[model samples]
Target: MSQCLNPDCLHSNPKGCQFCQKCGSKLRLVERYYAKSILGQGGFGRTFLAVDDFKPSKPPCVIKQFLPQAQGTATLEKAAQLFDQEAQRLELLGKHSQIPELLAYFTADNRQYLIQEFIEGDTLQ
Candidate 1:
């Protein structure tokens, strides 16, 4: 039985609630599925490289959780909405080889997180 991570969830059925009863967010998985390693940190948020447990043979993925500082309540709310929207957009772009696929989006403990496919390659620095 997996509990819905969305705070706004109305249904209490942890085992069968896929979408939040109030917001309708798909809520079957959470961060524990990934093996996280801190990759970097910046103004917007921190980046972590995590193993994609959902795919047994697949490579690791990246999860970015945005920082909530330096913004007013309205700005934060807008950013949250935009973040979710971008996740949806990225999910649609997942088919392309150049685009990283969006895996999940959820807010827990007052922070918003976005999980995406980690593209493995060299970095110029």
Candidate 2:
């Protein structure tokens, strides 16, 4: 069962909740473990290299947070929608050698987060 990550949430069970029973915030997909180390930060947002809590022996992951400034008013709503839509698209593109797998996507504290399988020993500068 998934537990609500929102601290203010009263409902913790994963059974019948669409949103937190107490605060109406969306529940977070719990990872068994993750250690985030900042990879880089830019006007767009920050990138982190996170060790998978679910499988520590396995490689880490890359998580990117989109910056509000990068998402301007002209495209805020549309960008947010597309950001989520692209994550879904990546999920469908799973395990392809040319495509990095999409691990998870959720919004917390009004910011969207995307977690993707990390390509170890890779550096983008």
Candidate 3:
């Protein structure tokens, strides 16, 4: 199944679907990652379990969408700044074997996304 990233219509669609059945949102992000399920969500944004179709192995990855829950322009701007900082930090920290490697980060459909290597097992959360 492919999961829709739209916050208003996060519907699940069958595999191979190019777009969400419910909301018509594209199933793929950056023309590669297909979000299968949500891993977690918080005030900052949401994390999704995804697969990178661009890779030969179609390896699993984590996709972080910057969807701040805070209100007001200042709060939203601050949240966006923090999100960018988090991505920058991940890019640097990923050099270590202990930290999950950053795969890709970009903005699409007006939403910012950060893709990273997936680590199996329970999350620290």
Candidate 4:
């Protein structure tokens, strides 16, 4: 199954589908990463459990969608800046064994996404 990346839709689609059945939005990001389900959501955006389909193994990964929910323009800009900062920090820190490695970061459909290594097991939160 494929999970739609559209925030408003997020409709589940059958395997081999290229677009969402309900919303018609493209299921694949960059024609590679496919989100399976939402992992968590916060003030800035949502983290999704995704897979890198470009790899032969189709390894699991995390996709961070920058969807700030701030009210004012200034607040939203700050939130976006913070999101980019986080991605930059992750790229630098990922070299450490404990930090999840940053895999890809780019903008798609006007939305910014940060794809990173998926860490299994329980979360500290």
- Distance from true location, Cα of 15 in model 4, Å: 1.6
- So what's the TM-score on candidate 1? 0.62
Model 1 CA deviation exceeding 4 Å by range = 1-31, 123-125
Clashing residue pairs, candidate 3? none
Instruction: Indicate which candidate wins on TM-score.
Output: 3
Location of the lowest summed lDDT over 10 successive residues in candidate 2: 27-36
Kindly list the per-residue Cα lDDT of model 2 for residues 10-100, writing each as its tens digit: 3454554546666766543343323235677665566666555566485677776665454457678777777778788989886676677
Residue 55, model 1: Cα distance from true site in angstroms: 3.3
Candidate 4 lDDT score at position 45: 82
Question: What are the per-residue Cα lDDT tens digits for candidate 3 across 16-112?
Answer: 9999999998898978999999999988789999999998999999999999888999998888898899989999999987789999989999999
lDDT agreement with native, every candidate: 0.63, 0.61, 0.92, 0.90
Model 4: per-residue lDDT, tens digit, 1-125? 88888989878888888989998898999999999889998877888999999999999999999998879989988887888899999999999878899999998998889999998866523
Candidate 2 Cα misplacement greater than 4 A, ranges: 1-35, 56-58, 70-74, 121-125
TM-score to true structure, per model: 0.62, 0.58, 0.94, 0.93
Q: Which stretch of 10 consecutive residues in model 4 shows the poorest summed lDDT? A: 116-125
Error of 3 at 14 (Å): 0.8
- The alpha-carbon lDDT assigned to residue 57 of candidate 4 equals 95
